[model samples]
Target chain A: MSAFRSLSLAMLKGLLRDRTASFFTLVFPLMFLLLFGALFQNDSVSRSHVLQFGEVAVLDEMPADQRRDLSEALNVEQVRDRDEALARVSDGDADAVVWQDEDGRIELRYSAADATRAGTVQGLMQSLVQSANLAETGQPPAFELASDQVEDKSIKPIQYLAPGLLGWAIAMGASFMSAFTLVNWRKKRILRRLWLAPISPGTVIGARIGVSLGMAFLQTALFLGVATIPFYGLRLTGFWWLAIPLVACGTLAFMSVGLVIGAWAKTDEAANAALQLVIMPMAFLSGSFFPLDSSPDWVRAISNAMPLKHLNEAVQGVLTRGEGWGAALPAMGGLLLFAAVLTAVAARLFRWDDT
Target chain B: MGPLNVSNAAGRPEPGATRGPTEALDAARPAPPRGPAPPRFGHGYHRQVTKNIPAIAVEGLRKRYGEVRAVDGVTFEVAHGEFYGILGPNGAGKTTTLELVEGLREPDEGSARLLGQPSWPRDPGLLRRIGVQLQASAFFEKLTAREQIHTFAALYGVSSRRADEMLETVGLTEKAGTRDDKLSGGQAQRLSIACALVHDPELVFLDEPTTGLDPQARRNLWDLLREINAQGRTVVLTTHYLDEAEILCDRVAIMDAGRILRVGAPSELIAELGVGNLEDVFLQLTGREYRE
Candidate 1:
């Protein structure tokens, strides 16, 4: 009884001791709420321009002649030179830049200063180019878009930023916590010591799972508490209550992945890197940064395998679409499956020490 | 069937120089009498006492990491109550072998038994019977010695109201409240040993127990370990200091590249290799080659 008590206390103390980890796990996801809440509402960016880079950067290297047509863009300035244009845009000397690539394409570069404004710019440019592109000419000539009512589909900064922040909290909380602790035990050769005793490997893994799961839940709660403020304010109605457990469950699901990473790597750094390897691409693809609904179908499909996709989708349903766990059940189910698989793998592959 | 096995360290390789007496030392220094003499292992830990039924039976132990064969076809056994040592240079699969024996890993090709039972059964009850001190261990950084001891003690279903008392046993009573991460290397090592002992295990494994400690600390650990052995518990220890092994282990095995080169008492191993000391025997068995 005392040993289990001590184990729980020890695990908690370990979490509290890591200042940086604590901040990331307990603070940052909701910080985005506060930061973005104050910045990117429709009223906030009523007149801002949208810059579409991946699609509209085509004019960046267009011959000086074709570039001349882009001056008509909203807050539109087609900076004639790439480096100078980039500098002005980067330093806020210009609201945005418009350029085309070698393929006789249309492109836009907006100040990344305000992501909301950037998204607004991105939304504006995408619509403008989509409606006016003259493929026969192999370029979209500069044209003023005159829509009395421009459907402003620019995502709120909070909505855009929430998924990635949440995903990071889940991935980081689990990965680092497990990796460092696991490898250190191995390096120290403590597991081997435990082995000479009658203790089974299952007990060791169960204890670790209990420890990491508790931490995972704590990470979610911290993020939720921080969410109470406005920019990061809780946008959900009663349905949000349902998403709470879903999100918490998602956090545990992701932590299981971290456990696997920790179990597989021989060194602490390797374990950490292994976690990032799993996290970075998944976070980007799983709509953690932006809604993947607009992304290609295949891209969206890949996200199904990522824990963050389910997590962000859960958040999106309750917070954005005003749905509940019933709506997010598919993603939640996927998360549970992922959790079960990862836990099994971590347990199966676990080593007692750094052998 | 035993006190909680909180800190039993499984064995690994260490240097065993300045060999002890071949047969005479078994009867040389005696304090507390041990159980009936254990039979020799499949081969032996270090010397040929005899081929005894093993308390730990390792058959064809093997491990692989992508491109590296960490442990390959290594086979050995450890008799109950023997002060066994596995001696080898760094990266010779000694630690890997120990991990397999301890049931941390599943054998890729072989089988291991702990007291006549398959070790991979994942029994919590089994851990309560062993005490271990690892080679490169870590504890909860902010946990005071008292806290760490109590916590680990609970995992194996044992309780010690005296975490501080255990610390005192390890000569760390004054520092019991300090966080483990703040302890000096030697102090940390002491606390680790204390963690392994708080539950009073019957079989204790110590992997490279004195790798980084100063001479005084090493000597202190040796005496402490001797005192532990005097309690009639089996001690399976590993170290790089040949003199320490010679002085401590009743039986020893020389391993190189995941294979046991020889096994006998320190003196017997040296005699078998026809060398003057452990270093000579080691040199004769394995020429100077940097093994990382």
Candidate 2:
């Protein structure tokens, strides 16, 4: 126990003294969050719409009060003909086009270029026309159109991004830091010196794991704090404390991979190559930048197998999706299993001496 | 097992009688009289006859790398508290021999016993009783001299004060706060020595301890080594400089082709070879060929 503590303290001191490592571990993730937050500033749950009306006769028949409500709900524009309205929608100047045929049935047209946004606009228009028809006809309605959003309107995209960024922080902290430290130690023959000490390899590895997990927690806390405290002030809900265990599991899962690379690679260059090869693809496919919903089925399949994907889902679930611990169980379990299996492999491959 | 076996001389139990699970159970039995044994110390039985046991014993230790024999059938012993040196040219297996005895490498055949314990066992207790400084003593770059010593000391369950004392012993007190990477060659070497001796082990192994130091620094290190030897600790060192072996070692072994060519006191070996100095003796034994 004393050996473990002393080694861990030494490892922590080494990390603190390394300026480049400190930058990547603590500062890099925060910079990423700030950049993404700035880029996604206008991202919101409720989207604005520009609706072009192809026929003036339909609008003239509506009551003045209903017309005002429709105008307020959308940026209502009157086009001379259907061709002009279709051009506006196709050119991305308008979200949709609405026209009433001679039989009095409402027709809707919109581009499916951005399927999610288009779907939202279509639902809103459908509800609006249904209510308008009922009021104008003065008849008892067969059914009511009621709607509820899972996310609150005030929730910004940055709020959703904060959790994924937290996972990003863990991935960078654990994988990059562990890989570099291990490779550097091996290159310097520091591992050889430690091997001579009256401590087992297990103890040395355990100390490293402890230090990496500690740094992961610190990175997560600092990133979240900077994102929420002085900047976005995003509220984390639904068993937010579970983020602690989630970060731990994620750290273990990622550090195990780093350990394997460090143990297998003979040089620092090789280690860096391996780290980049794994981290870059995982970062993109794991929903760090955008949702994977519209991604190809195979891409989604690969993302599901990634530990980072599980981490992002669990963190976003708690911080943005208002999900409890039960909702995070599958991801947490996947991370734990990944950590266990990879750690076993790393242990088998770990070598104290360069030979 | 047999009624009072005759092999159990001096009223001591037979070696086999104390094997396996019965050893601990029988430890409390009154020890047989062995000619006024020394007072037993913590965790170690100090039998009077233990003084006869050499600090290190190697018998026919051999290691091979494919077709090459790194350490081929080497055999020697260092008396307790003696300064022993192994002198050889590059690639002559001096470091390999040292590493084998240090338990850092496994030998293909034969065995080594340090402090009466087999060196190849996975027992860390043996490591606690011995210290080693490899040829290139790499350390944590950001660790100060004091912290490095403290870290290694903690591994051996030594106190922080002892770590400080080791720094003082190696004349590194003033540079205790300097990061290891920032130190000069001599300072780093001294710090390495201090780390090795932090627990004050019974034996110490130094592989080319002064390989890259200036003359003055080398002389200073020699003085420190002499002091360590005076404190009744066994020291085994490997060096390319024959002068270092002559001036320091009580016994020197000259090796070539993965085997010992000669083993004796420096003066004795030189006199036997009809040479005036170790340089001549080494050249006469190793010949004009460049091993490296």
Top DockQ prediction, candidate number: 2
The alpha-carbon RMSD values of the candidates against the true structure, listed in the order shown, are: 11.9, 12.4
User: Which 10-residue window in model 1 chain A sums to the lowest lDDT?
Assistant: A143-152
iRMS values for every prediction: 3.2, 1.8
Best by TM-score: 2
Which stretches of model 1 miss by more than 4 angstroms?
A: A2-5, A41-168, A175-226, A229-235, A256-266, A270-307, A340-355, B1-82, B88-97, B105-123, B138-142, B254-292
TM-score of candidate 2 relative to the true fold = 0.83
- Residue pairs clashing in model 2 are none
Overall lDDT per candidate, in order of appearance: 0.65, 0.76
lDDT of 2 by residue, B67-153 (tens): 999999999988777778999888899988988888877899989999888888655888888888878867875999999998888
Residue-pair clashes per candidate: 62, 0
